[model samples]
Target chain A: METKIKEIIKQVKKGDQSAFEDVVTFYQNKVYQICFRVIGNAHEAEDLAQETFIRAYVNIHSFDDKRKFSTWLYRIATNISIDRIRKKKPDYFLDAEVKGTDGLDMYSQLPAEQLLPEEEVESLELQSYIQQEIMQLPTKYRSVIALRFVDELSLAEISEILSIPVGTVKTRIHRGREALRKRLRRV
Target chain B: MSCNKQFINLMHKYLDGELTRTDENLLRSHLHSCQSCQKHFHELKRTTTLLKSSSELQPSSNFTEKVMASLPKEKKRVGYMRWFKAHPVITAAAIFFIFMFSSVFSAWDQDSQLSVSKDKNLIIQEDTVIVPEGVTVDGDLVVKNGNLKIDGSVNGNVVIINGEHLMASAGEISGEIEQVNQVFEWMWYHIKDITKNLFAFTNK
Candidate 1:
């Protein structure tokens, strides 16, 4: 699969533009998860992830083919998602890029229930707790933590994805972990 | 008892699995003795666990389709002949330098012979250039039409075009290694090389 992606990358670099769709499809889930984990939203993350691939497509020339392709893609995804967070209002997730109301919206189709089960409510609370805490983190720490936790990537890989020093990556993960500890202990 | 603030970073590193054996022992001793530190480490550990366990959001089924539809048209990569025809002066200079560098500096060997640009502290066995174990190569190494087996270390970028590169178990590379296994990759490699040279010249 890695070699195949490399070949596709070569083709894309050679101006076989249709080949980029394969790249997009191959990476969409991962790219979306990275954005979703960071931004804490489904719809905006999809937009940002789409924007990530599009940016990657347009700026593919800047990417060196030697390094891991996912590193470059993750870098683009991280930067785009963080930029959206920085530019918009602090709580953009509440009113963010929730695009068209496709009739197939999953939540709308679910049967209405008077209440979620107690365990479901507890898990939902924890989910919101986790989301709120993640959103509260500074962007630098947010991106690093998301990359670290979502993918369980090594600190070195995080360094490559963020283009920061490994030492810096370590420091951020340490600080980010400590920050989360301080916040979540309250819960 | 009271916890020293210094062991705070150690607690996080312990969770991250980055502690060296010695540091691990030290932190373990500290944790064994420190009550607050233990509680703090537990909280930190749980935070990461919960973060990992957080709900994952799935993209709409049409996500890839939407992204694919919205991409801007590719500028379209031009073939070398088209590029050369478009930039005649550059093409001429590039051709001149190609011959100049080939003949004067690192010439491509005819008859499918091996050509490696740097041989500083290199051991050659047939067509393979081996950076011996414990030896460090200080600069970029480009091998053409041959194989490179790095068992030691390279402090610079390694480019293998029309060749194979292998990393022995003990090998380490500080910079990236680019192995071009395809003809298209080879073309783009040269294009990038020529463009870099041209850009450097134009900047000057």
Candidate 2:
């Protein structure tokens, strides 16, 4: 699968327009999901997803074959989404302080081990709540969390995509998870 | 209390399975005994699982087509200016070399005392006229039907008729250099020279 992806990327790099369409077809859903999760809006996610592919197409020559193509695509997607979010809500991070139990920030709080009830209804509710809380996370935290959990990207891959250190990625993920745990606890 | 804080700190790494075997064992034992830490671990695990299990959102229909439509018709070719912008040092060096070459060529042309005359009608005389170094002609030096070469100094004007004028770098002319190779050019030069003397007389 990796070799096939590399082959398609090679074709795309060679100005094979049809091959680019195929590339888009293969990665559109994943790209859209990442954008949607980060942006939390269907319409804006679609626009940003389309923008990501268009940017990738225009700058395809810069794509280094040494790394994964998906990583490059994710980097474009996340950057576009982050830029859009920053533009739309200039003060987004200013209000990033999530209310926590006691005086501590929600990210500093450890999760409590209440076994989630294994019922379909409760599980669905928990899923919805988790999604909502994930959206509420600050853009930085939300980005790493979505890339790690939603996209199943490794810490190293997230680091490469975000152009940050793996340590920073881990810290964001840890904080994001704790933030979600706090939100879930309130529910 | 410090031990509990330490365990809390390691909880994320433990859940990630990034812990060393001994640390993993120690964390496991701590979790087993500490209800709060164990509960926290379970919640973290469940939250991660829920996040991973969330279904992907499908984009609107024709997402691929929209992206394809929006892409540029063709890749932009890197123009010379863009390349220059990318390699400013190389461009600067190239421009410097060109300027240097032209400067050197001009200096050589001046030093050689070549036929610097612009009038194509001017004829070259077989006999070479040389104003030797240290020779200074004070009054107007008019040459008719002969080449005039100046390697020293002329304090007054030099006028040539039907001949070429060559001036070396060491030559210095304090006044005008005029060449008239045709009958009409000679007439015009005289008329202009007479007009100039009239204007000087009028001014005086």
Candidate 3:
């Protein structure tokens, strides 16, 4: 897979624009997941995810060949996400319906009559509550926590993606977990 | 229900699924005996499990297509201009260096025809410049792509580029005589000329 991604990146570097679509298709979910978790908004996450790819495409030459492409991509995703929230307006968090604010929010686009399993519905609510607690964390801790648990990335990988030391990543993840526990205690 | 502080660190490792089996057993035994650690472990577990079970959220179906649709077209020419604009100092330095080297190299090849800086009493033969035996050349004499056979005195420096010199037994030069052939020396000469010009400008 690494070789395949490197080949795709090589093609992108060689000025094959269509080759970049493969890169976008391949990493979109992971990038979107990182952006969504960090930004806490589906619509804006999609926007930022697109921005991440566009930025990646524009700066493809600047992508260092030595580093993992995914790490570089996530770096862009996380930076865009953190930057978005830092330049915060209070309404930036995706409500159940920040309807028509940005077009076709996935949350609103769900079929109205489609039934979900009871267990799944309860679990999704639990997920939503957890997401709220995640949002409450200081933004620094929030990203590491999301990268750790949501992305299920290793501390070393998180360090590379965030350009921080492994020890600092561990400290943030530990502190972030404690913050979540405190917030969860409230509900 | 006091707990060992090390156990708290172990609890974090356990949550990360990083605890060695032996340490895990130790933690398990401690948690079983200690109510405070047990409660704390559960709270930590709840938070971690909640985060770990993050609902795999997918972007809308057209997410990729939308990303594809909106990607700034892979810019070709403008990108260079954009790069140049973004790093003004580097770009300026690069252009200056390139201009200097290019003009130097281009000038190097064209200097095969002989040229001299001062012509007063300086005799020019096809590829030989003669400082006539009896007449005094007034100032500095520069000869390029030729030979200088000097028989008269020069009051200032004599610089020869890609050339040779022959001095008569009576020939006199009051200032330094330098023969510059290598590109490096040419660059140094350029630097000297620039600094001299700058010095003159500053004095003015």
| Native-referenced Cα lDDT, model 3 | 0.79
Residues B1-204, candidate 3, lDDT per residue (tens digit)?
376789989999987778999999999999898888888889998888777775577777887888778877756686587678789999999999999889988888776788999887688888889888777777788898888888877888899987887764478888989888888887788778788999999999
How do the predictions measure up, each by TM-score?
0.56, 0.59, 0.57
Q: Report the lDDT of model 2 for residue B64.
A: 85
Clashing pairs for model 2 are A111-B40, A112-B39, A112-B40, A113-B39, A113-B40
Ranking, lDDT, top scorer first: 3, 1, 2
Better of 1 and 3 by lDDT: 3
Clashes of 3: 0
lDDT of 2 by residue, A1-28 (tens): 7679899989876667788998899889
Model 3 chain A: worst 10 consecutive residues (lDDT sum): A103-112
lDDT for A142 (candidate 2): 78
Q: For model 2, how does the per-residue alpha-carbon lDDT over B68-118 read when each residue is reduced to its tens digit? A: 887787635644655687799999999976885566445434533324223
- Indicate whether candidate 1 or candidate 3 has the larger TM-score: 3
Q: What is candidate 1's TM-score against the reference?
A: 0.56
| Runs of candidate 3 exceeding 4 Å displacement | A89-124, A185-187, B75-204
Off by more than 4 A, model 2: A93-128, B1-3, B75-204
lDDT of 3 by residue, A58-163 (tens): 8998987877888888889899998988787564343233455422233334442333465245444665666755655556677898788766888999998888
